[model samples]
Target chain A: MTAAYYAAVDWGTTSFRLWIIAEDGTVLAERRSGEGMTTAAKTGFPAVLEAHLAAVAAPAHLPVIICGMAGAKQGWVEAGYLDTPAALSTIAAGAVAVPDVDRDIRILPGLAQRDLQHPDVMRGEETQLLGAAGNLGDGRHLVCMPGTHSKWVRLEGGKVTGFSTFMTGELFDVISKHSILSHSVADAQVFSGEHPAFLAAVAAACANPALATNLMFGVRAGQLLHGATATDAKATLSGTLIGLEIAGALAAAGAVDSVCLVASGSLGALYRAALASLDLSPRIVDADEAVRAGLSTAAQAIWPL
Target chain B: MTAAYYAAVDWGTTSFRLWIIAEDGTVLAERRSGEGMTTAAKTGFPAVLEAHLAAVAAPAHLPVIICGMAGAKQGWVEAGYLDTPAALSTIAAGAVAVPDVDRDIRILPGLAQRDLQHPDVMRGEETQLLGAAGNLGDGRHLVCMPGTHSKWVRLEGGKVTGFSTFMTGELFDVISKHSILSHSVADAQVFSGEHPAFLAAVAAACANPALATNLMFGVRAGQLLHGATATDAKATLSGTLIGLEIAGALAAAGAVDSVCLVASGSLGALYRAALASLDLSPRIVDADEAVRAGLSTAAQAIWPL
Candidate 1:
């Protein structure tokens, strides 16, 4: 087995992932847990990182590189942010090292767009962008990273010109769990991309983006008047939000030659299907792999083996 | 004091209001409580109504006229709905009488737009619309009644052409209390129409309705980077939702010569200010008086002395 050289960690708000990589860029071991910044802040970031490193059997003196909310003001260390128009490569230089620790540990800084009208920030997704950028030999590209706070970035020749954060995922969670739509979707069965209601809603919202909140209310109205199923209600809600996000992202970004979607699992599938409905096929990149690749790029830049 | 001619009530989802009307259309006595449909459904709607009637010193034999959620399927009696394009004057003919009751108590039916794409229903707002219509006269008019679920109606002559319900107020409540924006607006101070943030947000959302959700996230980003006050965050959230509603309402209406705003108190002021910012000078009508006039109109139609 190749000896592990350095560890790469993505510590998010509510999740933690660590990978022990060999000097030649082969992944030797990996660990994932709920010990993200939120949990780590309470349990001790050092202890959380130590346990994950131990689980992966990482060498005690091995250098470690981290990205995400762990570098936030409320995270493990304040790594700060790189303001736009920011060069993706300069992210490695902004890494804030953890002092007084036995091992060499560094956390990558996030990216911030200070535009007065569209001020936005991304912690971990910037790393994902850095990694995804390498795959697209770019003139201009639109990158979408879908999650709790979905980030839509505009990349011009390897630099982040600007980006917008749509509160799509979080709004879905809150509206589904806390709003009046909760009752409409309580007994919802799991649905997918091909659901008629989902496709219809995507079309409706995309066509009339101004009627978003009205369309959301239609979920309840549909249930009341047309006896719409819980699955239908849920799908409509999901599709409406996703459609609105896509519309907004496209509106913010003018004509672009290529679009890249950096997402993983079910969400990635959902976005791909949503984009297809709009007649655009995005070049897909696994979010997990992109973040790892980003961390790897930062790792190699900071420490040459 | 003139003997009570009839009792008028506006029973909503979370609030209840009762007024004893004299033969000359004067409000002889009034009573208000929190015994709305939700509470009255569990506590007994008849008993709750009796308590309020007693408080207002309403005569036991006096007939009653009611509107709002009290006519909903879950309320005291299912008053059903009058489908659009409906004549506002015909509302009184659709009143459903309370069975096995000593007095002649009739609950006015709501309005339903059964459009396959935009199914919508309004329980109480129809009454407000009926009363406001008298003031609007003959013409193509767009009516905006802002609340938890704001109703935007298109009135051609005296007929209800179509309407849309924007979940603006409810979305604001849920997002402020449940979403991440909650933190940014936690310490918000009370703001008015003149707030710069509020006006700016209104303009931004009106200009780019597709970017509604994106603008929402800016509240948080503004707080983090620009040191935005909690009031600014709250105002921006409020403005974004309202602006989205106005934009959607107008987009759905197509063309209108005049706009009528039927609302009362602070919410009314806010909507007026928001509409004014969009260069729309809506003809204002007191929602409280409008509902009362509607009930009076229905009462005279049902039991003319």
Candidate 2:
């Protein structure tokens, strides 16, 4: 029998990625293209799918599961939102059925937080959460997904009870890239946490959260007065923002007791150290692995034996 | 005898503006061009000066005064800062004498706050303060200069002792241009202070300063949930930011008691009403007039008859 192939799509704002999977949930062929929601505006949805499929010679009909910006309001088709506290099993279990596909195509609904004093929302992270629960297996877990908008989510028995977002990455991008601090930072400065300069910035931000406004100028002061390198200054700025986010998140989520970070790449490792500074044990997991695992969970639901 | 023509140069990051003045400081001709610090990267001091002369026909032997980004470290020339409690007259009196100019050419030194726990800096706004002092003739005036980085300076007897910089304009630009709030706001919104909508937003920001962060999302929430028009939502966001800036500046400077604002233009007038909500009086003035008056103060100091 021909191996049943499944498709997983992580459609984001600036890029759309696709992974073709075999029956055993291994990625058969992966493809990435520039057809994100923003760029696919004039051409619209049909063009996005057609551009990605142009590379692969596959059967016309196949089961496909997708997540992320494709589910946003202005996306190809809005998948709406799954109100929290949402169960990982429930999230994996629920899918927005697509219209007019020769084969079954389901779009995942993102998690939404309302009815709280302050409402918050998330779209793609739900898939990551479901995948985390599947990988770690049905128990209480804390996941810190850091990006432009970092999400701190709590899962108990594979259900997402609550989550909060910190604009740390976006804030850093804005302040360091656009604000007065930009003058202090050089174009190319990427430092690791082991650096003494990085440690100094984390310590300062940790000591006084409000000092962020003033501490930003320290980059310039360091450069002008002490002749500190631009690379060190950039690292310091990043460390300061991450440290502040971690402190604020810990207080808000009460995650200091039991927190595990689900991040990827250098940003993930940086966050791991940031959490460690505040005496929190963090289990850093590969984000891509979780994305694949999530696709498997959805595939299993759709192709149950 | 022909009227002794004075020259005012407002050199900034991305643009250069100059006003040729008659003996009484009346503008004869004003010229604007994109020879700001950012554009004149390859060509240093001489290029910036030459760029100005190219845009505006000024006698090589004319008394000329300059300010703004040209004094920055990266500018054509770095004219050092004048420490506070600094009077405009003091900086005018101590104008940096640029060599090689046959006529009197003095670069005004920007003001800096010293007595405060942390120091603050101002370049172009010092000119605005001087203009306010020269025009209003001093006596406890509160001046608000709105721009990318807005400054609130408290002047008593033509002396700018202390001031605070609020990233109000920058924050608005960031949130509207980059943040999630951008979706809810329209391209432009008309200001009508008497409208219940406007007053409600001002009150919300004033009632709880910490709510400033929360208020930002209200623009989106108001549009999405409350059936608010995009224009109204945008206006509310703008009002809230400006209102927060006013409240924070007032509290920080301890100028709540008997404070009178010197604002410029209709946008300035709208802010005046926002200030009035807090039981403070604000007078609207012309922005161009303030710059001219400021230039005149600097000119008189360098070329005292």
Predicted model with the maximum lDDT: 1
Give the best candidate by DockQ: 1
Residue-wise lDDT of candidate 1 within A1-305, one digit each (tens)?
78888999999999999999998899999899988898999999999999888876778899999999999999988999999999999999999999989999999999998899899989999999999999999688999999999999999999999999999999999999999999999999988888889888888898888899999999999999999999999999999999999999999999898999999998898899999999999999999999999999999999977
Stretches of candidate 1 exceeding 4 Å from the true structure: none
lDDT of 1 by residue, B1-305 (tens): 77789999999999999999998988998988898999999999889988888876677899989999999988999999999999999999999999998888999999998988999999999898888888888889999999999999999989999999999999999999999999999999989988999999988898898899999999999988999999999999999999888888999999898999999998999999999988999999999999998888888988897
Lowest summed-lDDT stretch of 10 residues in model 2 chain A? Answer: A208-217
Chain A only: give the TM-score of model 2: 0.92
lDDT for residue A176 in candidate 1, whole number 0-100: 100
Native-interface RMSD of candidate 1: 0.6
lDDT of each: 0.93, 0.69
Reference-based TM-score of each model: 0.99, 0.76
Q: Between which residue pairs do clashes occur in model 1? A: none
**Candidate 2 structure quality by residue, lDDT tens digits, B1-305:** 34647788887787777888887656777888788878776666566665566556677677778888777777656787887787677767756777775666677777766532334677777876777665566467667776666677777787776776666666667767767667777554676766555666777766644344445554554454356777776677777777767765665566432454555566676677787777777665566677667878788767765
